[model samples]
Target: MADVRIIGLDIAKSVFQLHGVDDAGATVLQKRLTRARLLPFFEKLPPCLIGVEACATSHFWARELTKLGHEVKLMPAQYVKPYVKRQKNDMADAEAIAEAVTRPSMRFVGPKSPDEQSAMMLHKVRLMLTRQLIMITNATRAHMAEFGLIAPVGRGGVDRLLAIIDDQTDERIPAQARSCLQMLVAQLRLVKLQILDNDRQVLTLARSTELGRRLMEVPGIGPLVASALVACVPDPSMFRCGRNMAAWLGLVPKQNSSGGKERLGSITKAGNRYLRQMLFAGAMAVIRRAMQGTRRTWLIRLLERRKPKVAAMALANKNARIAWAMMMSGEGYREPMAIAA
Candidate 1:
């Protein structure tokens, strides 16, 4: 135990597998500990390097281990996958983590703070609520349509349906169907209120931090996007450049190059799917406004040559790079006109 220099911990709900090695990369200990015994075991162990996969409760464990004076490195599970031997089990995974962490070229994920984790949770819940809102709205619309109560597709249509439900004398909708639809209407109202509250919370979070404020200065980023970025990227310095950030967001094209021949495919769509979606939505919002305005910004020019969706992607990628640069430099966004001048 005293000789253990590097420890790889495979964490789970109750049991954890640990693989410990010495400075020369020789195994010194292999053990399993329960959830209750984990901290006590680490408490007695000497301060050393610990490797953990960046998965479900990884950040919490990393923080806990760091408090014990052990240097903790969180490696992305995908990056550690290559190090695993044929047989896959807790022991093998632990060993692979130990070996991978020792490599100088290995990439690592920085452990997020509790606040960052909380912010991410908030955003996820908001998204789930938003999806529920859509489900309720669609269900209500379909139910009403069966009774021949169709209206134009939009908020106005939904409003007309609700008004029909509210009218006591409306015989078009059967009593049973009307009762069930009232339940849906109640749910839709509740979800919309919840979504509004979440939006308020997101806006407050964005306005409360200097970093978030700076991020919002970018053209396509608003409260939700800015706040999500702050939570998702706790350490922007991990990226070497703005393009690296964009690539991390999976905005760049997939590459298949060999023998000096390069082939690029569609965007990898690899990183945080939620963030990528938010960026695309924001870019589309900007493109919509640009298409209507007289301004000839770069985005407008791109829209002229490419399809709107493709142009939106290009704008999203550009916005990601710009956001990364701003975060890295502690600088606010600058307009293209200002930069040109």
Candidate 2:
């Protein structure tokens, strides 16, 4: 235990696999422990670097281990995958984590605090509720269309749908059918109210933080985007630069270069999908306004040569970079001076 300098922990609900190595990179320990005994084992061992693949419970474990005086680092699961020797079981995965954590260039994910995690949970719940509402709304509309009752496009269209449910006098929909759909309508109303309540809470929380205010100052980052980013990312400094943050959100293009020839395709579209979508949607809003306004700068020039959607993505990449800078410097976003292309 005294010689163990690194421990790779592959965590599960009931069982955990651990692989430990000494300072000279020699395997010193490979062990499994039940949930009850895991913490006590760590509590008894000497302080060392503990590496875990980031997952649902990794943050909780990382927080717990940190309090016990052990230095804990988290690496992404994808980055650790290449090091798996042969078989892909718990022990082999733990060993891979052990090896990957020692690499000089390996990137680590910062452990999120309880409050930060809670805030992220709020955004996720809101997203889920919003999605459910859309699904129900669409399904209700489709079903009503079958009865020859159609509503116009847009959100206001739902009102006609609800109206049909309320109108028992309308012969188009049978009473039994109306009763069945009214239940769904009730559910739809309930979800909308829940979403509204969540939005209010998130807005209040966003106002409580200086970081959130600064984040909102960036073009296209509304209260929702600002709040979501603030909650999801505890430390912007984890990224070396703005571009790195954007890349982490997968806003950058995918590359395929061979024989010194560079080939770039669509954006990677990896990492935080919510953040990527929010940033891109925000960019679309910005581009829409830019088109109407008199600002004929970089974005306008880019739009002249590229498609609108392409311009939106480029703007999203730039805004992500800007947001990263703002978070790091504790400053509001300032439009950069455009240089000759």
Candidate 3:
């Protein structure tokens, strides 16, 4: 094992496969270890380079292995897929990771700290609760519409529907149906409260870190977006530039360029979907405000030439780049000069 210079670990809940290579790029170790045996084996092994595919628990293992003096590199699974040489299996995947890690051009994902992971978990729970809230609201609306009861839309409309459900004198909804719908209403209200609580926590997280506070100064990046970015991305220096960071978020256009001809399609929509979605939503909000404000910003100009959705995407991409720059430079966002309408 002393001859081993690099190792690729294919980790699972119970069993793990390892592929180790020597300085000469020859296989030195191929072994399988159970969850209980995994750490002890590594603890005994001398310090070496370890590569792992990023997944749910990859960061946890990476942190643990690093504590044992191993240099751990977390690579995106998609990037490691091309290195597979044969039929897919845990062993093959481990071998592929071992090979990929030594490549000069390979990309690596930064392992997230426990606190960052905790923040991401908070965001995930809030997202789940928000989805539940939407589901309950839709179910309530559907049930009420069956009895000729209709409301406009949004929270105010939902509240109006709830009011009708509560009115005992209203003959539109039968008592039995009203009781069932009230149950949905109660769930909806509870979810809203839970989401509000999540928002407060996210706000606190955003204020806790200097980087988070700087991120919030960017247009369209509220407490939620800022917090997620801080949690998901621990090292901004991994990206060479703002555009690379934007590309990492999959905001760049997909290209089909060959020869000298260039053909670009829609945004790749890869990387962290939550971050992309958050940025797009924030861009829409910014566009809405820009439309009402007296400033003639770049987004407003884009809106004149392209559809609103297209413009929103462009704005999202720009915001991602801006956010990356802010994170890298340790600087606050500066408002660009805009012409008066």
Q: Clash number for every model?
A: 0, 0, 0
Instruction: Provide TM-scores for the models.
Output: 0.96, 0.96, 0.95
How much does candidate 2 score in TM-score? Answer: 0.96
- Model 1, runs deviating above 4 Å: none
Weakest lDDT window of 10 consecutive positions for candidate 1: 295-304
282, model 3: CA deviation in Å? 1.2
Name the runs in model 3 displaced over 4 angstroms. 338-341
The numbered model that scores best in lDDT is 1
Of the pair 2 and 3, which is ahead by TM-score? Answer: 2
lDDT of 1 by residue, 303-322 (tens): 88999999989999999999
Candidate 3 collision pairs: none
Model 3 residue 74 CA deviation (Å) reads 0.4
Clashes of 3: 0
Clash tally for model 1:
0
Please report how far candidate 1 places residue 176 from its true position, in Å: 1.8
Selected candidate, larger lDDT, 1 vs 2: 1
- Model 1 lDDT, residue 85, Cα: 99
